[model samples]
Target: MDFYGIDTAPIVGVEPTDLPVIDVNDSRMDFVFLLEDDSYLHIEFQTTFKISDLERFKLYDAALYDQKKRRIYTYVVYGADINEAEEFLDHGSIQYRAHAIYMKGYDGDVIFDRLAKKIHNRETLTDEEQLQLIFLPLMHTKKEREELATDVVELAHQIEDENQRFRLIGATVGIGDKFLADSYIKKCWRC
Candidate 1:
């Protein structure tokens, strides 16, 4: 949320409800949370663009609304460049919309360089810095997934606190898996 400058209060995870929409077939959301104000925040990460993805977001939004009866804010974060900034689904009386965040808008090299400097100086990473580091791989496409994963893992290890290191590693592996190989990600974790 901070990455995109969206202000959010403290949030807690919300278990997904089984609201069966058509053709959903046990599909799960990427991440869902309950905000402090009792609204639902749903986020989906996509490596590539697909028209069906928008429909899935709509279904998730409808499900959340049906179960919680609260406002739902949904966003799709795309790892690849997208020409469109927003997606809208309108069917006569029904309308659904989601904001699109393009990862290419961020510069991974700048983020990595700042993090490396902080690590070199033995500075504790702020909460936002930690998050930026975890998401660094999505920002730039200069290197292959293996190379980027290796670099992120190396930076994650530089965290002085074991717990923070492990947490960052977990996030990196989880998100990096979309681009990196499982074996390579596992090796990075073991490191």
Candidate 2:
């Protein structure tokens, strides 16, 4: 995918059966998709920093590997800023890790302005831009998320293709939920 430079073609909608089973109250994975090359792409969205998350990822990796017999690539997209950079877990010979995409690392205003300019010029958004818009809610301060989500939703509506618009809206809501209130996110979705 353009957002993470994933080169393999995706096998959309393919679900893994052997992911770790949990009790009634245990948390599950955020997102999982199988790639055409038999690799599993795992994505997790985090709004709060937790040490237990890394342990969860390790379990996910083990279960995914058990089911698919292919390599698993995991990524964590953080909504809030975290000072720690512990993206890996190592216990002697065994190790588990995830690629971290810290939203705070990006300049939200620059990305938002670029998207706005494209929308203003009546130009269709490219795939990369669409991905950027989806993650825009996390790319800025908590105070700026609502405003950016509004603008991103507005621009998303301007996209002519109904399918693309819908997908963008869905992705926006998924990521926006971490930063924006439910009501505001619903309004953006209805835009």
Candidate 3:
């Protein structure tokens, strides 16, 4: 999981197992990105509003400060609209940053109508966030005799060779997805 120059260990479960649970009243951080500069970024994926979000971030920051002796930047990426999340932190000591990602773009009628039908109809992970799951199908689906022949054709066009492409696409898709794989293929093509 490389972000910029930092190689982050892939975040697995959301549950905070090792970290001590301090009372923040509401906010909960999902993952942490620790950098070489001794600064850490705490990321929280929120789906709902919590009154104690800012306070919790402060508490979490202080706790991390006490343990790691490093600066912590608290951030939240909410799956829903930001209004509720914003209202909870009007004035607070913990300066927090928030971002919103639309989870229902393709699943909902709004953005889906804007794209070409073919783009929308392709087999995709139901949740856009579940893009990581695409690797499983790309690998096994091509090998399975039961899968639609058209999928194999599409995969062949997108990737060259059968056996080699199957393995390469499988490995890359798990970590980077088809977009990255396509980019790499294009770079090689240009060369």
Candidate 4:
């Protein structure tokens, strides 16, 4: 909801959620939710771009659809380093497409400062701001993502609310696990 304006109201359930397709594809896909509209939302995150990644998403979607017999919509959230990525794959008549969301447009520094001030003031963060804090490390910034991630973790730890602090730290670490260094994630867990 914070990122894409797509309304997936009344989520039925998490369809298979995130079980790695180890026996078959030997790969894992990220968030998947079954919407009330009887469709699936498959959210995948990537820090790098490759044409093959689209095919992997297609394969995952096909497997899910085959099992559930429902339509699936996939969205690939690319990190700031990836300015652009192939949004679709075309092989002869077979066409596979996934919505691409680039983090390059987001100014991480500006957002970080704003959130920091809010936390300093002890103001409760809105839902969107919370999501932004989790993904801030992946957004465009002059500093290295790993460096920004440490700052983000530090900022999250500063939150006065314990639950909010823990949620943000966990989410930031989960996303950072794919791109940020292990040390940054270790720092997050150390909190």
Candidate 5:
């Protein structure tokens, strides 16, 4: 993951003290970071949108709370945008606060330039405030294969099982269709 403009410094109190793991049954979360205030950040990356994702996070949040008694904030890091996930907040019964991170294939240079400017001025922003930006391509066309690789790289990092990794890579390659394999490159270049 590119941290050039990403503010990972706000994170504190991360648990397990090891690399982020993928075993769902295990207490180790998919991507667990911490807020400056010591709150928990649980991230789940989904390439394929599933209707049950919200509830799944809710269950995870409940489990975390049951174990640690601290408020846990959750986010769904996804390749595509989802309205169904948004609707989950409409129902009154679920109390756990959650949000979605939509990833997209876009002009890496443009996004990086914007992020760089923001990071340079981050010190001017108030404490406890951070930016949440969704990277969706300004132009969305299923034509380009390399564009989709941005999402695939994230998938490779998050999935632990080798078989699953191969399967995901296969799926991502299929998404590319016929574009040159070399087309797959980082959204942003050097800092």
Candidate 6:
């Protein structure tokens, strides 16, 4: 939660559920967690702004509610390029809303440098730092988004823990799909 700067009750648990409730649907919800508060948290990563994005999420949340009959909190995490977002949609009696987190204020170059220094000194990366690495591509950067992403992938390769290294590298590649060129990611992903 802190990585995205979420301020809520201290989390005690996160259990994964079968979120793909619609078996034949092509649309997918990015991440959902059954939080400690007995409510569900539905999260989506958006690199661009579109009113339709909220519409799609509304449908997904409705489907999820139908399946689980639980309270759902939706949050849209916007990438660096998006400074503002539409947070609410009113459709007659039904109103849909999503909490927004903007990454425009964060500097990717500075985050990378700080994390790189830790790795250079052979320091174990905390879980927060690991998540920061996974999100490095989504932050503002001096270099092109693709370059910063690939560079983080290379830096992740140096992590001492094999499991941690592989997990974070794969996440970087997966998240990079939102903006980075497919060809560029394919070329640098080999590292």
Pairs of colliding residues, candidate 3 = none
Q: What TM-score fits each model? A: 0.82, 0.79, 0.40, 0.84, 0.46, 0.85
lDDT per residue, candidate 3, 1-191, as tens digits? 22112234443323231356676444335556665555676755444556566556656766767877966555554432333355234455545444333222222222222222423455332332123222222221213311322232234234333454454334333223222345554543343
**Candidate 6, after superposition: displacement of residue 81 in Å?**
1.4
lDDT tens digits, residues 18-97, model 6?
Answer: 45765434467777777676678887888998988888888888888998787888888888999899999999999999
By lDDT, is 1 or 5 better?
1
Which one wins by TM-score: 5 or 6?
6
lDDT of 2 by residue, 74-118 (tens): 888886465455688888898888877777777778888888788
Q: Which has the greatest lDDT?
A: 6
Off by over 4 Å in 2: 2-20, 23-26, 92-94, 186-191
Evaluated at residue 172, the lDDT of candidate 1 is 81
Candidate 4, residue 8: Cα displacement in angstroms equals 4.2
lDDT against the true structure, each candidate: 0.76, 0.73, 0.41, 0.81, 0.46, 0.82
Please provide, for model 4 over 1-191, each residue's C-alpha lDDT reduced to its tens digit, 9 standing for 90 to 100.
64655456556776555545533454567778788888988888888988777888888888787777988888888888897788878898888989888888999999999999999999999988998998898799999888888889888998988998998888787777777787767766776
Candidate that would win on TM-score: 6
lDDT of 1 by residue, 1-191 (tens): 77665566657666564556535854567767788888888777777777788887788788778767998888777774554555788888989887777778777887888899998898999988987887777775577655776798888888899999998887787677777887887787667
Count of clashes, each model: 0, 0, 0, 0, 0, 0
Q: Please give the lDDT score at residue 162 for candidate 6.
A: 88
What order do you get sorting by TM-score, best first?
A: 6, 4, 1, 2, 5, 3
Could you tell me the lDDT of residue 98 within candidate 3? 42
Off by over 4 Å in 5: 1-9, 17-28, 81-84, 87-93, 105-191
Predicted candidate 5 versus true structure: per-residue lDDT over 1-191, tens digit per residue: 23213333367654652322323443334556667866776766555565565655666677666666876667665553332345254457655556655555344445434544644554221221112122222113353424435543443434445554444444344333324244342222210
Off by over 4 Å in 3: 1-17, 24-28, 81-84, 87-191
